[model samples]
Target: MSYPDLLSFAAGLLVTGALSGVLAGLLGIGGGGIIVPALALALAAMGYGGDVGQHVAVATSLAIIIPIGLSSARAHDAKGALDRPTFRLWAPVIFVATLAGGISAGLFPGKVLQAVLGFMAFFIAANILLPFLERLMRRVHGSATAQRLCAAVIGYLCALMGTGGGALSVPTLAAFGLPIHTAVGTGAALGVPIALAGTLGFLISGWNAEGLPPLSLGYINLPALVLIGGVASLTAPFGARLAHRLPARTLKKVFAVFLVVVGVSMLWAAFG
Candidate 1:
């Protein structure tokens, strides 16, 4: 790449990381929604298109989420916002399911994964924005068996979509009767196990994949991971502070609107 292009790309990565880190702390989203799509576009623009590029994007997003999530979780915990019992209940199931999803990711088409991300984003946004849907979600609480089932699904889908699982987990936890802040805090904590297991699974599964980008270990792009992860971890605490200051209603609206944009953009990217 020319020096100008390299500079632009570097700038893009830094901006993406900053925004993603803020979202990770604010929404407990671990920055996957932003990172996965941003990395995919950046890779494609740099001539790394097609399935391998998408794989690299997802894998790298998971790798980046590890530190971001940890930072967000710590910040939330320091504020006494984390719901430890719920996190403990969900963590193991989420980790195992994410591992399974990551290991099997290569079996699915890139478009399929992208579509799943898009659709789920829309669903979560709708659940937040539409009062009836919000009411419906609230009415859907259940037993331990049911909650565990939901956690499994969240983990599996998060692995496929390269998300931190907060987009799904936050709303689900809220519906299960936790306060929104507590849910967000716990969701941030849950992201650690998901990212750790998913990263390992992707590393193992993509080890022999063809046409991977240079400086990649398996599907994870090393340069991108390091750059993004470093910047994101630094910014996450700021976001967590912001989240605490925002009202619960405003926070939900912010998350919902964010998801709407992500859902629409990702769907367009997937099928356009």
Candidate 2:
């Protein structure tokens, strides 16, 4: 790595760190959802080749989510917003499902994963853009069986897309009649195990994967994980502070738009 390349990589991580931190704080959305594509682009720009760069991005993002999810879950637990019953019920299912997800990821070309991310990004935008879609989501309410199925799907897909559970989980919980706050907090709690299991799966599956950058363990990039965690940790609180003053509707609209662009852009990078 030349000095300029090193500088570019570091700069890329910093930008990813800053934005992810703010979004994590400002929106209940997890940082990894945003980080996956950004880090993919960064890895490509750093001259990494083939699918390995995107694989590293996904794995590293999951690795980064572990601490963030744990901290968030603890904070929500302290507030009594976490629903213990739900956690006990769903966590195991998520773990098993995500382990499956991890295995499945290694079996495919990277474009498939890119498509998953794209679909999720669009799904998120639709849910937010007209919260009415939530009414349809409500139909699945009150079925323990349905929730278990939903949990499996959410866990698998979120892991595949390198997101914490909240993007889809919170809404699902709310549709089941949990209060939004409880949903958010519980979703945060769920993310800890999701990330942990997903991280482990990715680490094992991508071990010695072709074209991974130096110092990578499986798909996880240690430097990106370390640096992003360090910087993003510091900015989350600031984003939280700013969240109090921002108009909720406006902020969500802006975030939704950005997600759409990121999703399409990743797809373009992968397919185009």
**Candidate number with greatest lDDT:** 1
Residue pairs in clash, model 2: none
- Compose the digit string of candidate 2's lDDT tens values, residues 196-239: 88889898899857878888988899999988877776676555
The per-residue C-alpha lDDT of model 2 at residue 255 equals 58
> Local distance difference test, per candidate?
0.91, 0.77
TM-score of each: 0.96, 0.89
TM-score of 2: 0.89
For model 1, the superposed segments whose C-alpha errors exceed 4 Å read 131-142
